[model samples]
Target: MRALRALRPVQEPPARVTRITVHRPSPPLDGLVELIWAADSYVAQAERERVLPSGAQSLVVHLGNGPLRVFTDEDAIDATEVSGAIVCGARVTPLLIDTALGPTVGVEFKPGGARPFFDLPADAITGRVVSLDALWGASAHSLRERLMETSSPRDRVRLLEDNLLRRLARSFELDAALRLSLDAFEGRDLTSVGEVNRRTGLSPKRLLALFRDEVGLSPKAFWRVRRFRSALRALDHGTLRGAAVAAEHGYFDQAHFVREFRSLAGSTPREYLAARVVGTDHVSVRR
Candidate 1:
């Protein structure tokens, strides 16, 4: 249950880390871990990046980096400094992250996937970032020390995955109804709440309560983010017009798509795409 399946990571450390490519986790942790991603010191310039919501949470490990700096808003008020490993919660809105740092690694958790390990409601940490040491105590600090000494990304991943398996909850079990709802919501384009209920046979109230407890975001909210991400994928994969991309993703209209884009991305589609840095989500913005 604790063994890693295999490694097929892309060997391009110079690129910004977007998705996991190496050291797939074992079966026991599959429902919890969606991916494992890492990045080297690709850029040294002091800059800010907009981190859009992915309807998932993450545990980020800073390997010998100074610290992870996060701002509540563009104004950078009450910024939080995270050292070692940190748990990044679900984001209902875009976030401003300090991009003036070094190499890092992270584990992206699937929707409703983090419940078993933390012994708390998923919404407790949603839209917030908490240190791993705060959650896992001495074990987190020890893991960071081991990672700081190892230079290989593979070793880091192995260590991370092994530790996660060790920390796997023995008493908790994944909700069956939530899995059906997630599949229904993610399987179709523009899946409606009613459709999800029809597929899962759960009342709207039950669905909402389940999401709040198990997944942080409500069912409808999670589906909205999923739709937004679909549009992002379409845009990334091709050179399509905004209207065309909107249609492909089942947005109500170009105007509606733009509004959602601007709301979650902190910029219009044109602006974000035009200023996008190649091979990464980081965008150039004036400080």
Candidate 2:
């Protein structure tokens, strides 16, 4: 695959565009996905395909003058002149859409990376489109628009991070616990959920509940997905062999890895690598 632009967010307008901000993964977060941005004049006909990996979620903020339509396997949502937010959770199918007008700034948070921002059960979102006003208040739309209007990309990122923290403040403590457990698992195979609970000083049941609320997925599911992403990045970097990648990421073996890969990525490692070369404009995936 082509060397991805750095993980930092980029602000650049394509032809006939006013402005666009692309947010990449953070350096320490090499396993996450990239975020795309489009300007008011931006318009594209998206293919009828699912675009995100399992456990992934996206938050979109509309900053332009027009509206945009998002199509899921079952539903189509028209977010018009809605200078607000929309959250897309893990979908079994892809979203197809034809943009009419306006600029849309979005943040694509990968499986593990997005856990801290949401404090609801992962399954709570199935394949549904929700407005920011539905989650936050009416003022949320205007606030998001103002932040997106910031001229500086750095300022925009800071604003985004701040907003994320604010929205997830109730779940911050749970995120802290999860981060601690994740760090404990680094450089070693992940142990049982009970161990994670012990390390975090939370009961296993409480941990699961908190994790599901804050991160959207159960802790075990989050761990598995995060490990999968770790393996994917290693393979993407050409630093780990398939068998070794599975072992290193806490999979029982290559078979386990392949199963999880197929379930989450819809392909095997080799096939995913092959497709990765062709879909350079978007995020990487492992089948």
Candidate 3:
């Protein structure tokens, strides 16, 4: 199995549009791709914005004091008024322009990373955007205030993780089937869909449906993102050559990798890596 590692952001100056502060409780789950902490201080335009590439899903927790408007490529939604904390569930790549007031703090958990807590069938949650207040049966605002009051970042993260796990446990089982499947996909060559189905005892259709419900994308799509993340981490750590990384991760060739990377990451892998080297981090929303 491949050892899990952290991808540190380049410590350059912050970008002009947004400011982010991140906290990590521990190294991310092995099959999980990425995790991020982000905050914005002002409202953004309603114009379409590509927040993340295809295949990945995100969860957004609002720590602001104003309402947030979430717009997909085709629709606009007035999310809960930001008085407290709200957790947006998994979603495919879509335009997420923040049409709300500033001081928005949220965490973005990547595809595999989010799967541990949210392993449900996509149909169970189709077209439903839930407020954390509704899900927690309390005002999100109060919960967030309590969380923010904790001074220690580590403590805060542990608290957040505990809350998330508790909430999700009410809906899904946290057991070996999901954990082992995640571990099987890490670092080794990509496994076939049939093999995954056999090991997990879920039909391919059922597996994809469940993944989408909780994680917000199909299993095959999730696998691609996981592989992409693996290559990106290698690039970040300077541990693999470009071609070697591409071939090892199951890309047909370097061009195939580049095309897939650009489609999902909104830029070529090299360009994205270059930007990361300069401290332009990525942001994603979870509606």
Candidate 4:
């Protein structure tokens, strides 16, 4: 899902655009899904956009003209079209999105929280986008149809939540150790992976295994993503230059920060800030 912030639209969207709505799920569903959002934008001003990783995975069901197409590389070559209802896995690299607009309703899964929704281990699809049909078969198509048939955003969110609750896969459970690890690693900038292992009383190898099984990324890797997010937050809300931001986020120095940010976000801090689409992690760019 998009970050939790008030959006100032960079430009007026086309007349057909639906106002973006973000809704949080209730109770048990809230534990897994961070937020459900719906929006309609039939045309994109840019040919392609680079979406930075949010660490969490998301399931998006298209309700408009076409399915989402993402490019694997910066050149915008070799684009692959995913299903209308697809699950995007936790990733470290930027997603090169073809901004051909598709009205979409999406669910953002919390860290290690998507395990109960899919039969396979979370790590199985890390850094990749997989169709829900591949996991749920005909049920996925049915769910999308129902979503498309619903006009109200509220009804659509409720329908999606009820479907997820019913479709909960029992194959994997988020054990206590894994839960504790996520708690320790997520948003705790000062907490080291070693510290988390110590707190959980698990060896590094064993802990990493748990993280991969449930969280789709190693604890250190997840922490790195979270740190990048924190840096982004700081940059978004505060006036911090690269060196200051780097220091704030525990990088060795500005150079170290630049390298890591480039790896994860595909841009230097300044460039990313300059290109960022207000109210979103997407960096606007042409093909």
Q: For each candidate, what is the lDDT?
A: 0.73, 0.55, 0.51, 0.78
Q: Could you tell me every candidate's TM-score relative to the true structure?
A: 0.87, 0.63, 0.63, 0.90
Quality of model 1 by C-alpha lDDT: 0.73
Most TM-score-accurate candidate:
4
Judged by lDDT relative to the true structure, which candidate is superior, 1 or 2?
A: 1
Going through the candidates in the order shown, the clash numbers are 1, 10, 7, 0
* The 10-residue segment with the lowest total lDDT in model 3: 1-10
Error of 4 at 149 (Å): 1.0
Task: Write the candidate numbers in order of decreasing lDDT.
Answer: 4, 1, 2, 3
List runs of model 4 lying over 4 Å from the truth.
1-3, 6-18, 169-173, 187-191
Best by lDDT: 4
What lDDT tens digits, residue by residue, belong to model 4 across residues 91-186?
Answer: 999888877766677888888888788878888999998999998899899999998889876678778878877776333346888878777775
Candidate 3, 161-180: lDDT as tens digits: 66655544444333455555
lDDT of 2 by residue, 221-272 (tens): 7666666667877878899987898888878889998988776665678866
Clashing pairs in 3: 32-113, 53-264, 84-141, 85-140, 121-210, 121-213, 122-213
Model 2 TM-score (2 dp): 0.63
* Per-residue lDDT of 101 in model 3: 46
